[model samples]
Target: MSTTAIGINAAIAVGAYFMTVRMIPRLRDMFIKANLAGRDLCKKDKPQIPESYGVLIGCVFLISMFLFIPIPFAFDEAAATDALTGGKPATFPHDKFVELIAALLSICCMIFLGFADDVLDLRWRHKLLLPTIATLPLLMVYYVNYNSTTVMMPNFARGVFGTSVNIGVLYYIFMGKLAVFCTNAINILAGINGLEVGQSLIIAASVTVFNFIELALGHQVESHQFSLHFMLPFLATSLALWKFNRYPSQVFVGDTYCYFAGMTFAVVGILGHFSKTLLLFFLPQILNFLYSTPQLFHFVPCPRHRLPKYDAKTDLLHISTTEFRLNELGKLGRLMVTLLRSMRLISWQELEDGRVITNNFTLINFVLFIFGPVHERVITQMLMGFQIICTLLALFIRYPLANYFYATET
Candidate 1:
């Protein structure tokens, strides 16, 4: 029965992939006609491309899931028996279905908010809080379902906080913050062609692998199955989008894709009961966020767009820098800069006068700095490679090294 359901979902995913591909070009002109377009700033020609077309991906994904709603019931022999014999009517996974509906509602809200952001160009602070509103349905579902609020503690910390600590309301708070973080994480680490979509694809693929592993182990099969159902369609739509959004891109995914993609991962992670494991897959994004904290918090000057500086003459991208005067740095700021430079996390240059220039705090810029100037496509491939490496390390830590930290395999 599980195999049948998986086969059906796989078939639906294939259809969604083709649907996304076919609809993009047709919708491109419509998007442009609606004045939803942007120039590819990194390109030499700066071609005008349709933007905010991620609505197509979101719509197709939702429709695909809706079509799949009846598959599980069709395959459920117990439910079929119950219906015929008028036995227990509760044979169906009605609770799981409710959770699915709530998850879809939250995702739908995020898609609407993303499209609104694309159209209205929402402020940064507003974007930070917007995902919280979208996450309310998910939180409410979790509350009503009475999901576990206890978290496992490491062996070393067990002596201090016990083996597992239940934080109750704080767990919900953490989940809400997680939704906000996941929604914004992809948006902040983006620039260049394919980088956003590419990284997101890597994370989605990683999560899918994790789900499959858990399912195969017969560990929390239902949760992993739910995660897989959401991830397969998402992966299909994202892969289709990547084909057009790659280097020398024919279209831009815009902020809509970022929010939608982030929320997709968030939903699967939160509802799948593996939020902690999901975070392990986001190591790169977390590092990037930490690296950009000073700039993000306005301790240092930040530009509206900190994308790599494109050199049309060289036809390559180089590390973009932020200028700071010697006097502008407080003692702590100067110490932090020096520490980062020493750790080789950032490259710093001191001017003849009293000014300093350092590579902007972004994974993209850091890669460019480390590798020197390279073509946009090359840099994107490098970062994708980095993302893959990080995810692998995360899995290793989650499975193998986890035994050392916890009393048992986590």
Candidate 2:
């Protein structure tokens, strides 16, 4: 096994061991407190430590160690960057070890941030800055090897779509911004149990599949083939996390786990030269964030401690009227009024109110996932057709449904 791989395996073991021994109990207490405040979704009648935690952690660590230990067995250590980049795969070496260290530092930063958020309620700006800072080292590594000649967009499309942009300083800035955006996207979804982890597993699996395809196509750069080595460890880790993370869970993955997990996935995607593919894989979550941007303003006026008022006349809830029954519009309207009367909107409350937007976001995402793989021309046509159908549905059905449930009853 390569020394670097062995060192990484050792690191994982040490880190996991220390975390399990020192952090788990404290985390459990934090979850308990959050549950008391109704902030924790996983604390509903669940055990303090779910059996899944032990199983998942054990399996993930063991597998990662096993896969990572024989790095020397896989590649030569003394090769140059040119040798590796020139399409000759070398054995696992110090460079990869450095990558793991970067990942570990990112994970450590995330953990610290999560702890602060949980205890002190850190603001959004801080959250943004932390991840950006954490990613600077990785960005420097990228800067050193970046290709200035690579076309970001086609020359012909420069006028219309602005595709002729070069990968310059602005490109790195945008990349950093994208990394932060993705980190928070995963964070926003962390409110629900198992949702973030499940979504991540799906993304990881998708990327792994893509990587294997590249490998199978004999797209080798040097002696090293495009392999699933990095992703496999992450996949194993996530699977282990999911054991305790599933619905009605015991232990929460916390922002510590969630943020770093997302960042790790993002870093791997960038390193593997599949950032666009990764974007496609998480397209649903990305769409969710896009749709929620507007609602941030709408929910801002609402107080933090109370639920925000819903305007029955215009602001329609996505739920169907049939789901809540009263033959008369007045009675149903009264029920809706009563529900909103008890709710208030605060900064934290906006997070919950934002769920509706997130759901719609996911629905749009699902549509994209179903149709995203097709050629651009075909997708545009399909979207046009779908828009027409949606227009008709809204005009004929959804509008009436809203009128029935939300219109002022005389």
Candidate 3:
């Protein structure tokens, strides 16, 4: 593609961004009228705000995709851009078309699932389980269309054990797991105002930037094209949501945005054939999920909302704690708590009444733990900064691994 093509593509992306921003007010009003608002529980005032603007955000992305890369009958731009085709229909790679179709189907599945969760206020258990079905198309496409799910072992492992070991069918299972984890990981590491979408924006931007660098360096063109197409729209809608969701939020995105945003990334990762690189980009969210696994598994009692305690007076957020009585615990419980405390992932205070309060296990709470009590806004920015740092680190690390273990068209 030439500079003129690049400029045209960018204009389309900017138009999508502005279009989503323009749609938010109407969506906000719609949520309000439907009484789908949620209280800003992190704030002292606990003001009600309309929720699930992701509906429109998803709309913008899907619509933009149709316009930007139309299905055969969707539109005809052959006359304008197909000088080389010379009246022959501009043809897309069959594999690329299949991947994009699968991606679109997967994202659509996620959008409807998110909307249902937003309206139903589904439980965490249901949230985890429901997105599995949404990922079926993604997994099925990978198996039928892409076919090979075998992953090569790391370079170091190859030197030690032999040439790269194929993981075989397990790789498809891993892809399915990746889809579920990506969707839920974002959902879990959220609660702070704009933190969810803010981190998402940074991740999308980082992936997009990395894709461009790969392109400029002359790596695989098709993979990079798929990545840019998926990410540009995701970044646009996320930015638009952040506009309303920042600091003092005008609207809450609820679960709908989280599902849509996360699944979109998953689709890009799978279709672009950069799923491992994609996981690297989400290192922070992955770490948060691992850190919170004890609670997730019921080793520790998990609260419906584990958000940091917000003090309105100073506008600072404090780490919130969950109570677990040591006396009520078995040997396994005592050991788990001690291990987490030793890792400094949690701090606990034993009460005279036999209950112990353990700090909330999340990246947001962990930031509060490390930085001390900071303004809610400050913490949100700090976490987003961590997101950027992690993503950049991933980019730097990916090339070495990809070159040695995963060969690509470069």
**Strongest candidate by TM-score:** 1
Lowest-scoring 10 consecutive residues by lDDT in candidate 3?
Answer: 71-80
- RMSD for each model, in Å, please? 1.9, 14.6, 3.1
* C-alpha RMSD of candidate 3: 3.1
Best by lDDT: 1
TM-score order of candidates, top first: 1, 3, 2
Worst 10 contiguous positions by lDDT, candidate 2: 316-325
Query: Model 3 shows how many backbone clashes?
Result: 0
Error of 2 at 260 (Å): 1.1
Name the TM-score of candidate 1.
0.95
- For residues 17-119, could you state the per-residue lDDT of candidate 1 as single tens digits? 9989999888888999999999988888889999887788899999999998888667775677678998777366777778889899888888888999999
Model 2 gets an lDDT of 0.48
Model 1 off-target regions past 4 Å? Answer: 81-87, 329-332, 407-410
